[model samples]
Target: MPSGGARASIDLSSATIAVTVHRQGATVPILIDGRIVMPTGVAIGPTGQLYVGLDHAAARALPADHRYVDNPTDLLGTPTHTHDAAPPDPVELLAAVLRQTTFYAAHQIGQPITELTLTIPPHWGPRRRGHLDDAAHRAGLPAPTLVTAPAALTAYATTLGLTVPPNSCVLVCQVDRHPATLTVLQLVGDHYRELATQQITTPHDLDHLIAHRVIDAATPDDDPLRTTINHPPDAPADDRHALLESVRAARHLLVEHDRAPVLLPAPRQPAVITRDDVTTATQPFLDTAAHTVKEVLDAADVDTAHLAGVIVRPAPGIPALTERLAHATGTTPGVVDHPHALADGALALTAAHQPGPRAAAARLPRVRLRITDLAGILALGACSLILLLQPVLTADITTVDSYVVGARTSVPQIGSSGAFAMLTALVIAHLAPTTWLAGTPTGSPAEPTTGSLIRRGYLAAAVSGLITATLYGLATGTALELDYRPYLTWTLGAALPLAACTALIAVTAPRIPADALPTWLALARPAIHYALLAAAGMFLMRAALSLTIPVDLTGMPGLVGSLGAALLGAATILTITDSRVLRALAVPGVAIAYALVFTYSTKSALIVAYLAALTWWAVRLTTKTLHLAFPNAGAALHRLVNRPHS
Candidate 1:
C-alpha cells in the first residue's frame, strides 16, 4: 500500500500507449517503472490472453510519430484492417503478448516475468486456450490461469460494498439474454460458501435482450443511433447488435423506469424496483428458486433459527426479484449491487474458504468424480483419442467378429477398420453431443430418445463384452477350430445380448430414472443394465437354437457369435415397441414367423442389423410418447417431475 514499494519493471511508454490513474496526483498502476494503460484494439489468444490487435484502429490510437523494436507483421493480425489482415492466429496472438511483455520486462526492466494473469470471457474454448499457453512459453511470462468474466466482475462488486448476513442466505442472480444464473452464497467466518448455481432460463428472460435494451434505451424526445434489425427478426442476434441494444436499453431505463432504490446511469434517477414488480416480472422463477434454497439449507444442515437474514444481488433485471424470494421463504434477505459478486467472491473464497490450488481438482468441473467412478477429463481424453484414430481403427464395413458390407474382406483389415470406426465414433460423440443429447432430458422419462437408445446400445455392448470375456476366461476356452458357420454363429451371439438387454430395459426402464444419477454414473447404468439383459437374451436364443436345429451353431467361442445375432433382434424389439413391454415382446413373436416364412438360412449379421433398426424405431416412437406425456417447456428434469400442481 506504500507509494514506493518495489514495482515489477516494464516500460509502458515504449509503445504508443498511455496510462491514466485516478489517484490524487499519484502515478498509474504499473508493473516495474512504467505506467499501466487500458489495452485497446486487441484480439485474444486461444487461451484468452489479450494480444495487441493489428486493426488500423489500434495504430490510429497511437501517436503518428511512435516507434517500436519489432515489426508489426511479426505479431498476429498482420495485414491492417483495410487490407483484410488474416485474423490473428490464436497461438501467435498469445505468443505476441508474451513476447512484447517479456521484451519489456526483461531487456527494458531487468527481470524475468514469473507470474501472469488474464481476464477473459466465460465461454472460452479449448483449442484457442492451448495456443495462448504455447505463446506464453515462447515469451518469458508464466502461462496464465483463466479468470472468468463473472469472477472479474467480482472486483467491481467488492468496491460497491455487497455483504451477506450471518446464518442468512445471499442469492446472486445474474441475467444475460442467453441465460439466467442464480448463485446462492452463504456467509461464514471471514468467507462465504456456495449454496447452489442453477442453469435454468425463464422465457421472460430468453428474448433478444439487445432488442429490449435498445427499445428501453431510446428516449421519445432525444434519440442518437437509429436501430435496425441486421437480419430477419427470427435470425439469431449477433454480438455487435446485442451490445448496441444493451446500451440503448440502459439509456431507456435511465429516462423511463423509476430508478429509486437502484440508480440509473442518468444523474438524476436512482434505480427503482419494488418487491411486487420483481415478483410479477420473474413469476415462477421464485418457486423453483425457493425450492433450491430449501434444498441447499437441508444439504448444509443449517438451521434457519441460528442464521442471519438473506442477501440478494439483483442482476440485469429488477432487484425486486431477490426481495420476493426473501418474502416467500420467510427469511429476511439483504441486498448487494450486482455485476461483481462472482469475481469478488471468488477472490475471497480463494483466500479464505476455498480448497486452494492444492485441492483444485475437486473444485474443477472437469475433474469432479461421479458416483459411477468415472472422470470427465479421462472420458474426454479417451473420446478424443478414439475420434482422432477412428478412420484407421474402424476402417472396415464388415469385421472378423462381425460381418461387413462394402468393407474390406481380410481378417486384419476387419480389425483395423473396426478400430478406426470405433475411434471415429468416440471422437465424434464427444465433439458433437447431439447424438448423446438426443435422449430424453428428464432424469426419468417413460420413453427414451434416439440419443438414449444409442447410448444404451453402446453401453450394453461394452458390458456384455466384459461379462462374456470374464465367462470365457473362467471356462479356460482354448484355441478351437474356426469354421464359417460357427464364426457366423459367434457373430450372431453378440446381437443376442443387445436384443435381450433392450427388452429387459424396456420393461423396468421407467421405474428407475436414466438422468437422476451423475452424468458419468448415469451413462454407465444403462449400459450395464442393457448388457445383462442382452446376455440373458443370448442364453435363451442358444437354448432354443440347440434344442430345435439339428446341426447347432452352439459351439461358438466367447459366446460372441450368439450375442451378435441377438443384438439386432433385441434392439429391434425395444425400438419397435416404443418402450411398451407388451409391444416389444410381440416383436420376437413376429420375427419368429417372418424367419419361418422368409427362409431357414438365418445369418447372425442380418439379425443384429434387424435389431439395430428396431432399437432406433422403438426409441423414436417411445420418445414421441414421452414428449407428449412430459414436454420440455423448461428444464428437462423440471418438466417430468410429478410435483402435484395444486
Candidate 2:
C-alpha cells in the first residue's frame, strides 16, 4: 500500500530476501526489510527447537545428532495432483518469512498486504509458483499475481517511459546470487511478452567465488582470520560480517576502479582487489553470462542483428558481465539503472491487474536467543561502560600518583579510590572487545583429552604461582610479613601472573602438537587475566598491612627490575621453544640468577629456581621430554610455604 511505483516487489535470492516499498510521491523505491537470511538454511537446535533463517546456531557446524536441512525448497516441492503427498514442515519456514513480510507491511503501511504481485525467476516453472502460492495462502495472503522476473523488468522499463519498438526483441540479463539468466522479451503494441528464458549455470555463484579468492589472496596461511572463516568463533559476529562485506565491497570497486583497498583485521593485510582480479577470478562466470544471452536469443528464434535492445541488471561487479553480454548480443547494452527494476515492474502489473482484497493480519513466529548470546550481550555492555569511564579513572589514578609522590601530599595510604581505578583498569584490559576474538579457538574436539590438557595448563599455572611465592618467602625469611614488602610489589605482582601463564604454556607444549601450539598460545596467553589476579592479591595484602609506599625515585629501578625479570621469563619461555635457542639463553640466564642469589639473598634463589624450571620445561618439551615431578615440586612448594608444620 506504500504506493510511489504502483507495485511493491520482493527480491528473493539464496543469500537473503528483501521487500521494497515505493512511498507515495517518491521517485525511488525504499527497502522495508534489510535482514539477509539464508533462504536454504532451516535447522532444529539440540533442544528440538526449530531455528530457521540466518542464525548462528544453525550456521555453525552442527553435531551428528543435530538436524539441519539445506535448500529447504525441496520441502515445498509442488504436488502433481490433488491427492499428492503433503509438503514438508519447511512450508512453515517459508510461511514464517511471509508472515514477517506481512507484519512489516502492516507496520509500515498500517494495513496487511493480502494481494501481492510476486516477481520470480524465469526458470521457476508452474510447480515452483504453485508452491509459492500455497505458502502465501498459508501465511494469510490471498491468491496473488505471479510474474516472471524478466516480464516484471520489462513492465518496470515500460513504466519508466522507455519505448519498445513493436515486433522487436529485447533481452533482459539478470545476474543475481545463484546464476546468470538471460530472458528474451518480445514487444508487441507497447506490451512486453516473455518469449524465451535461458539459465547459465557454469562458473556458478560469482560472488561466493570472488569472496573466497580475496580471502585467500589477502590473508597469510598462519593468520587467524583463515581459521575463523573455516571454523567460525562463538563471535563478535560484527567482525565476521564486516570481513565478508569488505570482500564484496572490494569486488564492486574492482568493476570500475583500477584497484580497491579492502580493510581486513590486523595480521591480515587489506586486499587490493583490481579490475584484472575481478575479470580473472570471474572469467568463467562472465563467459557463462555471455553464453546465456545467445542461448536465450536462439531459443526465442530471434537474430542478434534484429535485437532491439539489451538490458543488463545494474550490479557493481557486473561491468565485465555487461561487456560480455553486449559482445554476445551484438548490441550496445543499457544498464537496468534500478536494482528493484523487477519489483517496480511487478508493482505496476499488480496496480493494473488489481488483485483480490488484502489478507487479514497474521502472527509471526518468535526467534529464541541462547544463553551464550545473553552473556555476550551483557559482557559487551559492561565493556562499553568500562571503556567510557576510562578517562575519569585515569585522571583519578594520576591524581593519586601525584599525591603519593609530592612533598606536600596528605592522602592516607593511597586511598581505595586509587586502588579501585587500578582494579578497574585491570578489568578493562581483560574485557577488551578483541578478547572474545583472541579468547579461544573453535572446532577443538570436545573430548576428555582436551579437558585433561586444560587441567594440566591450570595446574602448571598454580605451580608457577606457588614457586614464585616460596621464592619471595625464602628471600625475606620465614616470617614473610607484609612490613618487609618492597616498593616493587606492584610490578612484581602484575608481572608474576604473566610469567606463570608463560610457564603454563611451556609445560603444556609437549602434550599439544607443534602445529597447534601457536594458536593455543595466542588464545590462552592469560597475561591480562593473571595481571588482574595479581592486582587483587596485592590489594588484599596492602589493605591487611595498612601499607603504602611513598613514591620515591629509588623505587623506579626496583619496579623496572621486577618488570624486566618477568618479561625475561616470559620471553625465554615463548621465544626459546626451540632447544637450540633454549640452550643458548639458559647459560646466561643461570649466570645472572646465580649472581642474584649471592648478592640479593635467598630471595634471589626463588628467581633462579623459577627461571631454571622454565628453561628446563622449554628444553625438555622441545626435545619430546617429559617431567612428572614438575607438578609435584609445585605442590611441595605450596605446602612448604602455607602449612609450616606439615
Candidate 3:
C-alpha cells in the first residue's frame, strides 16, 4: 500500500469486462456499482449446444469427439477435437468462449461490455499471448490486454491492504488442476517484474486423491466403485466426471465444515469426508508446492528474510496449502478465496497501469530543457565569471579579513563581489529551473520570460551584496572582535529574508508530477526532502553562530580543523545506520553537541555547521544525478541504504 491508500483502486464500468481462463474453465467477473457479478464459465458443444458452467456436465456425457473441456493449457499446443466434423481452431474456440462469457456477463449486469482483460500463466511467452489476442479479435472484440496470473495475484493482495514496498520481492504460489506454479515477483516501480517462475507437476491431483479416499471408505474391496477409482480413464465418462465433480464440491464444502458428504457413483452410498481427509490427501501436493516455492526464490536470488510477502492461490481442495507456504517462506501467506481472483487482479492492474510496450515506454522519464533552464544556466555562468574575476580585479587592494583570516593581510578574499555572486547563483539555481525539490507545478502555464528570471537573479545578488558590505564594515569597525549581540542581530535579519525567499521559490516553482519521476527518485523523494530540511536548519544555525560568538582570531585555524574532524566522524557513523528517525535526530544532536563543546568560541562551530550543510546538499544532488543517469545502480544503492542493519 502507498501512503495514501492501496494502489489497486480500480475504476470499473459497464464498458469493461475482466475474464480469466485457466486449466478448469473461463470466468467473467465484473464489478458494477461496488458489487461483484460473476457469470458461469461457458462452453460450446459438438452439436453447437451452449453449455454454461454446471450445465457442462450434460455436454461432457456426449461422445469424446463431440465434447471437450475448454482448458487454456491446450492453447500452448495444437488444436483439439471439440466437434465431430472438422475440428474447431483452438484459438477460434477460445475466442468464442470469451465472447460468450462477455455476453453472459453483460446480460447479467444489463450493460454492454466493450473492453476485455485476460489473465494467463506467468510463464506464457509472446506466442501464447499473441494467440490469446488473436482469439479476442476473432471473436469480434477489441484486442484484449493480457496480464500474468502471478502479477494479478499481487494486485489482489494490494486490495487486501497488503503492502509490498518498491524493490521488495513477493512469492506467489498458485495450485490449480494442471500444475502448481510458483513465481517470485519483485515490485520494481508501480508494476511487478517476474523474477523467477516454475511450474511443478504434483504427483497426484487433490481432487482425484480425495475421490480415491471416498471410494475406499464407502465401497467393498471388490466393488465396481473400487475398479472405477483405480482405472478412471477406462470407466464410464459420465460416472467418473460426476464422481469427480461431487468430490470437488465436497472439498469446497469442507472449507467451512469439519466434514462433508461426497456423492459416490450409482448403487453406492455417499461417503462422508472430513477436513482431515482433505488435508491428508493434499500433503504430497503441499510438499511439492513448498519445495517449488523455495526453488523459485533461490533462482531469483531472493532471501526469505527479504521477501515482502507470500500469497497462495490454492486449488479448491487445499486451503491448508497456505500454512505450508507460510512456513516455507517464513511469512504469513494471504489466501485468495475468490473463484475469479485472477480475473479481479487482471482488472485492477489494467485500471492502474497501461499494459504492453506502451506502458514500458511511459515509465521512462521524459525531460527537455526549456527557456527558463537556459536562463538559469546563463545567470550561473555570469555569477561564476564575477567570482573568478574578483581575485584578479582586487589583487592590488589590501583588505582586512580579521573576521575570517585572524589578522589583516594583503590578500584577495571573499569580498562583496564574490559573496554576492555566490549567493545569487544559489538563489537562481533554486528558483529559475525545476529540480526534485522545486518541480514544475501540474497544469501550470509556460515558463516566465528570461528577463523576469534575470531580474530576480539580480535582486538576490543585490541583497547578498548589501549584507556582505554591512558585515565587512561592522567587522572593521569593531577591530574584528564583535560580541554575540551585533552578530546575532545580523544573523536574524539575513536569515529571515533568506528563509522567505526559499519558501517563495518552493511555492512558485513548477513541480514535476510523481509519475514523471524515475523510480529511484520517486522512492527516494521522502528521504531527499528530509535531508534538505536538515541541511537548511543547519545552515541557519551556522549563519547565526558564525558571527555571534566572540573568538580568538589567532587560534581560529586549529579550532576550525577540530570542528571539521568531529563533524566528519559524526556523519560517517550516521551513514552506517539505516534508521531514518535516528539519522534525522542525530543532525540537531550533533549541532547541540558542537555548541556545548565550543561555547566560549562558536566560530569554529559555525564553520563546521556551514560546511556540513553544504556537503549534505552537494551529496544529495550528486546522488540524484547519479540515479537519473544510471537507474540500475541507483536502485541497488537504494536497497543497500534501506537494508536492515543485520
- TM-score against native, each model: 0.30, 0.45, 0.50
Among the numbered candidates, top lDDT falls to 3
lDDT scores for all predictions?
0.37, 0.50, 0.54
Give lDDT tens digits, candidate 1, residues 1-646: 1111111212111122221111111222333235333232344434444545233334334443332222221333233343423344435544564465445544443333333444333334565455556766766555554444333333335445544445455544444323445454555554445555554444434223333333343333232222333333544323334444343344335334543143222333333333344444355565555566665556556555534444443444454456656665566554544322333333333322221121101111122223333343244334323322322223234345653333222221112122222222223232221223333333333434433443454445434433432332222212122223422333234334433443443333332222211232233222222322333333333333332222235664224334534543554455344357765667676455434432113543444444355335434433443442233434557646856677
Predicted structure with the largest TM-score when compared to the true one: 3
Where model 1 places Cα greater than 4 Å from the true spot, the runs are 1-140, 143-170, 176-178, 185-195, 203-248, 255-313, 328-646
Deviation of model 1 at 564, angstroms: 99
Residue by residue across 260-300, what tens digits does model 2's lDDT show?
88778765667777777777778787766766677777889
Residue pairs in candidate 3 whose N, alpha carbon or C atoms collide under 3 angstroms: 1-163, 439-510, 439-511, 440-510, 440-511, 441-510, 441-511
lDDT per residue (tens digit) for residues 479-542 in model 3: 4342324433433333334334433332222122222223323322222223222223323323
What's the true lDDT of residue 550 in model 1?
Answer: 22
Ordered from best to worst TM-score, the candidate numbers read: 3, 2, 1
Q: Candidate 2 overall Cα lDDT vs. reference?
A: 0.50
Taking all chains together, the TM-score of candidate 2 against the true structure is 0.45
| After superposition, candidate 3 runs with Cα above 4 Å error | 1-55, 58-66, 72-76, 79-84, 104-114, 355-646
